[model samples]
Target chain A: MQDSTATNARDAGRAAQRAAEARPVRIAIDAMGGDHGPEVVIPGAAMALQRHPQMRFVIYGDAAQVEPLLDGHPALKAASAFTHTDVSIKMDEKPSQALRLGRYKSSMWRAIQAVRDDEADACLSAGNTGALMAMSMFCLKTMPQVERPAIAAIWPTVRGESIVLDVGASIGADASHYVNLAVLGAAMARIVFDMERPGVGLLNVGREEIKGIEAVKEAGRTLREANLPNLDYRGFVEGDDIGKGTVDVVVTEGFTGNIALKTAEGTAKQIGEYLRSAMGRTWRAKLGYLLARPAFDALRAKMDPSRANGGVFLGLEGVVIKSHGGADVKGVAAAIDIAYDMAHYQLMRTIRDMLDETPIATAS
Target chain B: MQDSTATNARDAGRAAQRAAEARPVRIAIDAMGGDHGPEVVIPGAAMALQRHPQMRFVIYGDAAQVEPLLDGHPALKAASAFTHTDVSIKMDEKPSQALRLGRYKSSMWRAIQAVRDDEADACLSAGNTGALMAMSMFCLKTMPQVERPAIAAIWPTVRGESIVLDVGASIGADASHYVNLAVLGAAMARIVFDMERPGVGLLNVGREEIKGIEAVKEAGRTLREANLPNLDYRGFVEGDDIGKGTVDVVVTEGFTGNIALKTAEGTAKQIGEYLRSAMGRTWRAKLGYLLARPAFDALRAKMDPSRANGGVFLGLEGVVIKSHGGADVKGVAAAIDIAYDMAHYQLMRTIRDMLDETPIATAS
Candidate 1:
């Protein structure tokens, strides 16, 4: 069974790799999604185009606002088809409210619709996370066998990077949801990390601390029992394992995952503040900081949150990426880069096939 | 109503302060706890004894193993009464199994029982967290109105330290449980941080996202409406807000709180690794590192995990502290220091009073 599953995955990977090499990935951009809107998105698309010349864009936004910015980037403009929409979702709008106020006519909805219509291979949004997720679910819908969609983040670790999923796409999860998260996250890790069988771990507390939530333990049993070929289930990992790169994919429910993600970001910022305050304490410290400018710059670059900007919406029928609302041009480009890879590799079909192959009964 | 609550708290604080100043705090030492056992615990107790001369100790452990170690610390030996207990809980023992095997005879359980029997003011242990919590709950039990006890950690933040509670004492929490956590955490914060009304915040996702769990929303309403005098309830705070010191006490369920705490620790460690690697990259960086030794030392001191080593078990009828099992002498001393402060301030009575004063009906 394992050998046959391996062979199946290899064939699928090879087929995806070959097709990706032959075609350009069409990305639908919600130009007026984030804080800076077209001012950042247009230039970000231009930057992404430079990295992957085989990328094309289908831009949707208010024409007057986005057209001027698009014209500023000649290369991106030349490879893009522009669509005009007068409405754009507000950053602070609630998910349900956003759906009511701007569902059909909004730039965010239209961008996701393009992907469903087969006009774009993938969709990218830098709007409100809740709004973007709601619209994506409404427009693209969940794939077969997927209970609900999840958001996956590329976490930077000492060993490189790992994929963490269910970072606040929803509130609660059951046993099957955990299994779904593990499978979906593994599929993303396989594509992102470029591995045949990405190791997956269920996020849990210390082993000595009375086993974690019951759903986590149940999911662990199911994953271990099934022993799917495309992914290796490495039992349980604690919160620290995410930064240690102990596994390629860390699966968790949305509530804890979101809190963990935000807490890490907060800690990094706190340390940065401490570092700056320490460095400015004395004249000698200031001189040392100046001399060690390169080291500081390197550290800054490594800890830059924008480098890991994109949050891929998993278990969907079409590829969707949600960039941070406050992300700058570089960060937006990072999101687009993920969209390009995911769309190019046909992640939706990959997830569908993997889901169909998984034994859901084992989870029960 | 607010003014009256504040005045009542102030009077209670003054009475507790006078009583604390008039007497010595006796701490029960589980000498068999932690990795180094009596070798580290004796020295740690000695160190804490130096700073707090009025502290007395009731040490429990295997006399054959602990007698020689105690003799090495003359002052601690003189101030402590030693008891021989051969049974000790293993680091990996399940909570239930630990109870069955080591409940009555073990050093960990006996230390907790001392507080309950009024033989000691407080208890301290560096044994298995789950075992300690189980023993603590079983021996000390919950105070009136507290559904279950919570483990509160003194979290280091940019502004200062914040008290975060329910960091894995138990898995799930209801609205009333959250209220208990908030009240208990605020009582500790008032003693540790020396504040009349320490600002409290409910740990939640971003205000913009869909509202958090139903229990969280319900708790928010309860805390807001009750308007307790001992704590200033500042609506909602996200995970990042913990590090920003946005609130004096950050309240959440054990599952998410534990994950957030561990995730922050992992992030801090990861950045430290990144910094070290960057500093070693070039000769200039090395030279600069040497020149800025003081700055690095300061940052290291700021980030030292040992400085915040104790987890105070709140909502209990008596004070109990769980130190890290892998902690060294300094870390153990830190935990003892917290135990001393909590005992001195009469935390149990403070919590009891607050619980009695709080309108529990509002929580539902």
Candidate 2:
């Protein structure tokens, strides 16, 4: 009986080793990217490790700073490997300057390079968006059938969640680019939601067929006529439809997408402010708030922006997740969570396969 | 003593008559325009009359339908004059159809005609926007030095309200049109908020002067260099600034403006849903909600879309206020209130005078 138990333990060890060898997702993080830098990113990585035990991290920053922070948490220290880099990209530095001067030296550059070198499954950053995008485009390049990359955000909706694309990757997408966004965004929605056929819509001012601009109209025409296989092209969706979860994917040019995102964020914050002021009006209201504090706390957790933190850059050969520069420890963890999921699901491979199969005529 | 009292009464009557002759504000209403038609409009007019005793209304629709609704409200009956019109434009009618078929005979057309004929000071309608704009443009025409009219909405902000323009008036606007929107929006702000120098901003994706498109870039440059009077052109604002009340006027082309407006509305509704579900979670929460019902009611009123329902079409020869299609009595009242306010302050005349005095290089 003792020999049988020993044999069982040996079998378990072999199974664990085989599993690691089969496929292990590793996320490369820009440790010196955001406002708090290593102070926030290290703790965030530690917490993330608790949730995702299989996940491994390669943190890029000054070794002196990042190592000390990781030491405070043994789990993160055990799961992570530090890559020393003295140079860090400044938050205000222009994309051109960052690319020209700190190409291979900067933490942002090295983090992205890890993914390109096949050392990491995905790269996550809370750095300067423009500089990051420039570096990413330069290093990874565009995927097959893609002219430009787009930032896809998991937007919270009334129904559940929807993916919105081109939330400030580049501005002024023509008809072809709009159609491409639909294809790319649908690829994201499928992997994120585990859906076989996701519904995609072009973001417009109105749902009426005759309402939007020429580019949007042409994109709608193309989407309708082409009949893509992976996604159900649900012609046009308005701004309100986004929060209502009218479709699986909402696609638009960068300018409009960026404005819409910021607008929604502002509106949510505004309503929150209104709620706070309302509940604090009278003594009776205050007591009521205390009694219902648990419910409110639950709602707060549900509405927390950290849960919807990551913006994955699609149409790139490698996966890249961008977190808000001002995001705290929780937000950083949220972004890393996205990176882990994308890598585990082989999101980049799926996107490449889908693009190669997609029959877009204007994919130049 | 009796003779002196008689003399004082006579003098007061003459003074009142002179005041009425000087500038009496009159609003024209399309009684059969919205979902509930006269049922909501007459009651709303009555409510508005309670607030503005000096204002009068011209009701246009089937006299048989409108008269009875006004009959129950003696105040509205006393404050309004009815014009019979058997034809009413359908809510789904196209702009071309509205202009072609319902030109002179329809209630919507005649209501706008009132403003043109000087029978009413301004026009108010809770009808299809496309149809209303068509009929308005045909009847009143664009003002001199104006290329096209734009819809300006009074957006509720943390600091009172700000005017956001081109909210689905036209799809695309050039640099000249953006400059025109700023001037036109500022003019409305000056009259509505009683500010001599309203702060105007071009709504863009970012606060950075280099972030937006060519048109917006050129507009910013022109505004900064021109140093226009009656408005302090404060460069560019972001989507969130509209709700934050960073400026008195927010300018954008129709597409972005409409989407931003609708997105904010959707976000507001989304938060409200979250709030409702949260408060209904448990018996304790239910009891707390009951106790804090008054505070919630106040907050609801403060966030009420009805209070900010009116979308005033500016740069037209006359004022035309558009209300939401599914508006209730309170919402209808809000539109009428805007009409009354615009007429009382002679908003159109002020806009024209401002245009004449302004030195815009592209006033063609």
Each prediction's DockQ against the real complex: 0.79, 0.58
List of clashing residue pairs for candidate 2: none
For model 1 chain A, the run of ten residues with the poorest summed lDDT: A1-10
Q: On residues B179-298, what C-alpha lDDT tens digit does candidate 1 reach at each position?
A: 889999998998999898989988887753238988888888889898988989998889899999999999999988888988998999999999999889999998888888899999
Clashing pairs in 1: none
Worst 10 residues of 1 chain B by lDDT: B1-10
> What is candidate 1's TM-score against the reference?
0.94
TM-score of each: 0.94, 0.93
Per-chain TM-score of candidate 2, chain B: 0.93
With candidate 1 superimposed using the best TM-score fit, by how many Å does residue B70's alpha carbon deviate from the native?
1.5
True contacts kept of each: 0.74, 0.69
Question: In model 1, which runs have C-alpha deviations exceeding 4 angstroms?
Answer: A1-22, A208-210, A362-364, B1-22, B208-210, B362-364
- Per-residue lDDT of candidate 2, residues B1-364 (tens digit): 1234334433443453345358768889999888888888778888888999988889899888888898899988888889899789888888898888899989999999998887888889998999999899889887656778899999998888999998999788889899889889988999889999999999887777777799999999988888877889998998888889999999999998998898899888888898899999899999888888888898899889999998999988788999898899999998988988887776766676566555775444
Candidate 1 lDDT by residue in tens digits, A1-364:
1245444654654565465557689999999989999899989999999999979999999999999988788899999999999899999989899999888889999999998887888999999999999998898877646788999999999999999989998788899899999989998987898898999999888653238899888888889899998989998888888999999999999989999999999999999999999999998988888888899999999999889999999977688999999999999999999999898766766675677668664221
- Look at candidate 2 and tell me the lDDT of residue B32: 88
